[model samples]
Target: MATKEIRSWAYDELIRSPFALPQGMLGRLAGRLMLWLNDPGELVTLIGKADSVLEVGCGPGGLLRNIQAKRVCGIDPSPDMLRQAARHNRGRDVELRLGTASDTGCPDGGFDVVVSVNNVAMWPDLEAGIHELRRVTRPRGRLLIAWHSATGRSPIARKNALPEEKLARIDHALGEPTRRYELKNLTVLEKHCQR
Candidate 1:
């Protein structure tokens, strides 16, 4: 099979059984490794103090814990991951749900800010995911999409990296972004809604 296909299959398997693949200690270590690799603080900084925030592909609820929003919701394809997120975010105002990026099952214009960090590459359909993100964001809301590039040449980084053309297409679909910038190994795409 092709490399992308292999990666996708692996991702699918992981989503289906995140707790069993790497096994016991190894799985715990791998989860921690992922947590260390994904830091969405920069994305949260851009979010400011939104009333409601939705995070697509939120693994373990790291970003949800940091965000100072009145309401926070996190969606991910892995039930195991969501369970971990629920555990990590105990006593916090957060909701964890099982959903993919393209079909979050959130209400229309329900969030003041929508974010996806380090999860775009795993999206089954990128354009459809973008549309879904836009659909759930309120008019004049903020959208923040970000990814990490300094993953020590990991296959996941290579698989998930957005090409220039794909980035352009995402920008086109979202309309002009309010700001686009890169910090350290992180690249962020932000847009302010007009709809």
Candidate 2:
């Protein structure tokens, strides 16, 4: 997603509909259930002993909580989203930062794992955000990103639903075959993540 397109989607689609599916009532329930069911796979894999975790664009801290790490931090560019996260994670160990992914205030090698769901492609400077994530992650750390493609939304709440033109912009920006990635490893994008 390009800057304007992603920004618009975040404000219009994401802000308006944080929970539920992008399809309909059944989709919403299925999405909700999937969130819980998929928790162990997404959360557990991003943690390790002696690891400090950082989550970019963490919404409501659900992923943050599910990770089950004592040392964890999160950042989201939207104040509204941060407020929601604060309300949910108040008095918890999670440190929620109010900022964008591209310029998160963190020191080099500050974290052992950096995780994001449904946000990497949305970044205006995708590589910059990736750079930041890599910088914060110590050697041997991992970065995980998840996204919901145009096929459909499991939770069909109102979505900004990018216009075909916007979609084209994103397709052009990211290059061809923006396919789903395997969790096992990244034989691809290794140049971006290597220490």
Candidate 3:
């Protein structure tokens, strides 16, 4: 757990902003805002079809609801968020659990695809989170890490877009042969093959 050390205090603080780590009543409000602001259609299209999918930092399960997979799973650090996700995805076959990016609680090589949206920068240790995500994905499976986009139409997305250096660090952690895609409100870093 702590193996995934915080990258730095300042970065941790920035990532753990109230909206990013929602709690209490305010957290509920933030979850509602997230549901309205973030759309998963582009991601779903990019991911295409899969037998199974795992969404880390799944927030309110918006992506989970839209993902076209026979088996969909979501993990989040906040119990409140997990509750929201469960409620939001009711009547669906989605599995919602309380977990973090560094500890997904998923079996190794169990997923065809593992994705994290709008929470890559929020990860306490980007490398450790990526490593865990990689561990759970089958060989040649896709790892999709998306965040606010620099070219986003929304000011919120533009303001929160990661700097190039930070993006490069993520690229390095994901290893070579990764591709970058700019969607309406998200910048997706897609990696294939497992180290």
Candidate 4:
């Protein structure tokens, strides 16, 4: 399904309802796991210095807090995730936008770094998400997509080696190199202005 539909479903499934969404020790544990999975210093190194950073699927915005960018914003499909991120950003200079990687509300070339953490593996259309990442990121800006790959398989990637179809989609989407780290299929994509 398209991102719009997925966003709508996410909004309904997570928020706007009278009942409460899932939360508790497990959620907290999972949040911590996500934080550990996406190392902070590595992100700092990747970005060099934080400027206008945008994080896609920033659940709870834990990683966003670590990066001291001039201006930081986040986009996620789920309202619950947005709410969680907002709560995490309480008293902080961070903007949480309700959207998806496929289409964020920000203007083009507005971000110095476009990073997606603990997401993308389950993206309904990964290519669309990558295109959006390429769109918002500034010239020569970086795009880091991190997913929990227990066996280094993407969980969806099955292995660091993406199949021809997936590679084709990524190639056609970002129009640049998407490298996978050793033992971690958390794909890192870079985009340049004149690519």
**Candidate with best TM-score:** 3
Off by over 4 Å in 1: 1-28, 150-160
lDDT per residue for candidate 1 within 1-195, as digits (tens), equals: 111121331134424234222224444454566677766666667788889999987777777888888889999776656776788799997989988878999999999999987767556667788889999999999888876543324565555566676666656766775577675455678889899
Off by over 4 Å in 2: 1-41, 46-50, 149-193
- The collision pairs in model 4 are none
Give lDDT per model, in order: 0.72, 0.55, 0.86, 0.62
Worst 10 residues of 4 by lDDT: 1-10
Model 2 over residues 70-167: C-alpha lDDT tens digits?
A: 68898876554555567667778888887667788988988777766656546666656666777787776666554443433333211423344544
Model 4 Cα shift for residue 190 (angstroms): 3.1
Each candidate's TM vs. the true structure?
A: 0.79, 0.61, 0.92, 0.69
- How many Å off is the CA of 4 in candidate 3? 18
Q: Which whole-number lDDT from 0 to 100 does residue 104 have in model 4? A: 90
* Alpha carbon RMSD to native, model 2: 8.0
Colliding pairs, model 3: none
Q: Tell me the tens digit of each residue's lDDT in model 4 across 65-88.
A: 777888989887666567777877
* Model 3: lDDT of residue 150: 93
Cα RMSDs, all models? 5.1, 8.0, 3.6, 6.5
When 1 and 2 are scored with lDDT, the better candidate is 1
